[model samples]
Each structure stands twice: as structure tokens, then as C-alpha cells.
Target chain A: MTCKEVTRLISESLDRELPFYQRLSLHAHFHLCIFCKRYARQLLFIRETLRSLSQRIEDPVFSLPPLSEEARESMKRRIREQVLPPDQGNLEQ
Target chain B: MNRKQPIDQHQTSHPEVWVDQHGDYLFRYALLRLQNAELAQDLVQDTFLAALRARHSFTGQSSERTWLVGILKHKIIDYLRRSWRECPVDEIDSSLNSIEEFFDKTGHLRDISHGWTADPGTILEQREFQGILERCLAELPFRTATAFSLREMDGLPAEEICKILGISSGNLHVLLYRARTHLRHCLEIHWFVKIRKD
Candidate 1:
């Protein structure tokens, strides 16, 4: 397989299982091809970066603006209305 | 001989505390997926309300955040489905075509001769690297980003992603391929290549 074809296969390999013959040739190409090998490694790295980032503990550094105070108050109010008795005023714990 | 303190089920399940506990996290999850603050906020609000109504079904199997996120995920998919018809499939195709510039007529790579200098572990630790990655992800077509995020970020399977994105399995593969190619290219231009120069 050519470099272009092998690289596409490498990308697809991440998402799905490839046929054995295709996988065999892809590895064979990787043996002789430094460029496609680097390509595959870099793509794998990108995938890892995203996966880990998703699982990482919420860091303020990765900040998207949090819910505003007003929004929070309103959301709490709405939730309280549903859970608390209708006549029960705001209860603080 | 000590007795465990009796905790009120109502107190444990109260949705107001949920607002304080999971609200920001859920908001950020929705914001990343939807990219609209108002809509994200609304979805988080809706998720809490939905959770409250469904409180009795809380099996305690998953963490509270996970359960809430599951609810938000459905909401996000519903929003995407509503907008799916307007998604420009041709635009996504043109973007993939741009990636072909990396290859020659003989199907050989043009200029990616050297490996990246920074190690993946080190790069993953850098906050700035993530910032650049988020920017690259934002550059992708909406549906392409949705497929990539569901698969890569959320660790969802392609079959599941296809269902959520309302695409076929083959189309999901194409979207994933496009996502990886575009993100790699974008990072090369914006981050990796720049690091090489410096």
C-alpha cells in the first residue's frame, strides 16, 4: 500500500477493526515507512490528549465560564419549587 | 457500640444541592458540546429539572454527575438532531479535500519527513497544548466535531455515536477520519510546526 492509503487505514484502525489482510499490509508498510509511522503516532497522541482531557478533574485553568450567580439562584429556586412543599419557603441548610 | 447517623433520603436527593454540586460541571459539558452559553445554561437547568422528576429511578449505580451527564447527553443529541438537516455535508467534504494537499500524485507524503519533537506525555501535561487542541477542534465542521468528541472525548463507541449524530456507521468512519486529519494538520500549522521553528 502507498503512504496515503496506509495513513487512511491507520486512521480508520483507531475507530474500527480492520480486515486482517489490510492490517497485515498496513503494518508491513509501517515497517518500511517512517513518514506514515510518524503520522500514525501523532494521530494517536492527539486522540490520547483528547481522551485524557475529557477525564481530567475539572481544572479552573480549562475554564469555560461557570454558571452565573443569578442563574444558579434561579436554578436552585426552580428545583426547590419542585422538591419542597409549595408553601415551604426557601430552606437553607 | 455506635449507630450510624440517619440521613434523610430527601436531603441526599435534593436538587438544590445538585445545583451547587454538579451545575458548573454540567454547564461546561453542555457548553463544550453546544458552544452556546445561553443554550448550555438552559440545558443544565433542564437536566436538573428532569433529574428531579426522575429521582425515584435513581438506581445509585452511577455517580450523580454521570447520571446527570447522561441526561444532558440526550438533550445535546436532541439539539443536534434538530439542526442536523441544515448541516452542510458538502462543506465537510471540501474540508477533507483540503487534507489531500498533504499527499502527492503517487500517494506519497509531501513534507512530513520528521517526527514531532515534543513527547506525547509531556505535551499532554501542558495546559497550553489543550488550549490549542480545543481551538483546532472548534475549527472542524459541527457534525465532524460532534462525531469526534463523542468518540474521542466521551469515549463513546462509533455505533453509539452514529445513533446520536443520526449518521450511518460508514459516515461515522468518514467523520472520524476527517476529524483526525484536520486536527493533526491544524496542530502542525499552529503548534507543532511552530515549536520546531523555536
Candidate 2:
């Protein structure tokens, strides 16, 4: 494959979406081509690094703060106010 | 542990309860992708509001966590659509060229795979890396950045991305290719080269 063909296929190859024959052809080209090899390495590095970054972002500590009792009650009250009409306050009795 | 049971049961029983319980997780998830705290907070709020409004649609095919995340995903896409406009196709080539120059000047095209580490535990703990990533993300055109973040950071599939962005598969591939290429160059410049120097 020419450099242009290999270049065009780099994204698909990294995505693992290329057919087996296409993958083989790309691999063979990458082995013979210094630029394509560098491209593959860079792509791999970027993918791994971004994946790691995302995992850290999902850490439990980074999640929302736990609801304190006051906050929880406030949220409940807000929900009730939205769901209940003002005239219904006396109907519960 | 027993004291937590009622809370768990309440969350399981009502979607609103679940949102109150997991709003922070959803916010952080959106924030990482949006890279804007205010937008992320809004997306989380919209997600919960939509979930509460559509609770009857819940079919139990997935766990509550997955259900909440699904709603959040849609909310994010909606937010992206409203806030992000496409760059003219004419601008793509110039942006791509600039990115190439950025990489070249930073000497990131050189090899340092021997010293490169793939561990997120180490990489994310560093403030410099985070700052670099934020800068890199800022350099991207809005739509490309959003698409890339949704696919990579949010783990959404390309097909879903296409549906969300209303683009053809080919267009989505192109957008993703451009985004990834830019990010790869930036990461090399900001992280890899700096690490070698250190």
C-alpha cells in the first residue's frame, strides 16, 4: 500500500474496525514504513492516555458530594412543592 | 450499613430519589466531557429533570445506574447541539496544518516510547498533565472537540455519535479522525516531550 492509503486507513486500523485482510495489509505497510509506524504508536499512546484520564475522572471521590440530611430534606421539600398544589396541603389530613 | 438500607430502597423505588443520590456522579461525568463546569452542571440538571419527567419510560432493561447514565448521555448530546456549532469545512485544513506545526515545534514527533507509561493512576494525579490536556482541548474547534469528547471520554459508540450529531457515518469518521489527530499531536507535545525533558 502507498503512504496515502496507509495514512487514510490509520484511523480505521486504530478503531479495530478494519477487515482482517485490510488489517494485514496495514500492518505490513506499517512494518516497512517508518512514518506509519510512528503514526500507529502516536495513536496508541493518545488512546491509552485519554482512556486513563477518563477513568480518573470517574473516580468515586470526584463524584457528587453525598447528600447531607439538610440537603436531602430540602430536595424532598422542593419535590413536594412541585408535585403538590398549594390547595392540597389541607387535603392530606 | 443497616441505616443505609432505607435510603437505598428509596433510591431504587423512585427515579427522583436516584437523581438526588447520583446527581454528582452524573455531573462529574458530563463535566469531564464538556470541560465546562457550568454546562456540565446544567446537563446534569437537565438529565434529572428529563428522567423525572419520563419515569414511565423506564423498562428495567438496564440497571438504575445505566438508566440514569443513558438519560445523562442524551442530555449531553442535546446540550452539545444547542451550544456547539460546526466549523466551516474550509477551515479544517488550516487547523490541521497548525496542529502539525504545533507538534513539530514542540519536537513531539521524536520517539520516547521507552519512557512512556500508560497508567492512568500516575498520569491523572499530575497537575501539569491536566493543565496541558485542558489547553489541548481548548485548541480544538467546538464541534470536533465535543464529538471526540463524547466518543472517547464518554465511551459512546460511533453509531450513537452519528445519531446524536445528525451526521453521516463518513462525516463522523472524519470528525473523529481530525479530533484524534489533533489530540494525539497535542498530547505528544504537552505530555510526552515534557516527560522526556524531566
Interface RMSD of 1: 5.2
lDDT digits (tens) for residues B1-198 of candidate 1: 113322335324567889989998998888777667899999899999998777767878888888998999888878777777677777676545465787888999776746776765457667777678777877887778778878887788778877776789888877788788788877888888777788
User: Who wins the lDDT comparison?
Assistant: 1
lDDT of 2 by residue, A1-93 (tens): 655456557875654388888889988986776766777766666666677677665565333233344544554555555544522443443
- DockQ, all models: 0.50, 0.29
For B1-198, candidate 2 gives per-residue lDDT tens digits of 223332223334554475466765676677677767766766665666566656556666777777888888778777787664454655545545443343344334333333355464566566677777778877777677877787777667888878877778787777777776677667776788777787
Off by over 4 Å in 2: A1-5, A19-21, A60-80, A86-93, B1-20, B56-63, B82-115
Sorted into a CAPRI-style docking class, model 2 comes out as acceptable
Scored by Cα lDDT, where does model 1 land?
Answer: 0.78
lDDT of 1 by residue, A1-93 (tens): 778778888988998899999999988998898889999988888877776666653665565678899999999999978876621322321
**Clash pairs detected, candidate 2:** A64-B24
For model 1, the superposed segments whose C-alpha errors exceed 4 Å read A84-93, B1-11, B86-88, B94-97, B111-113, B117-122
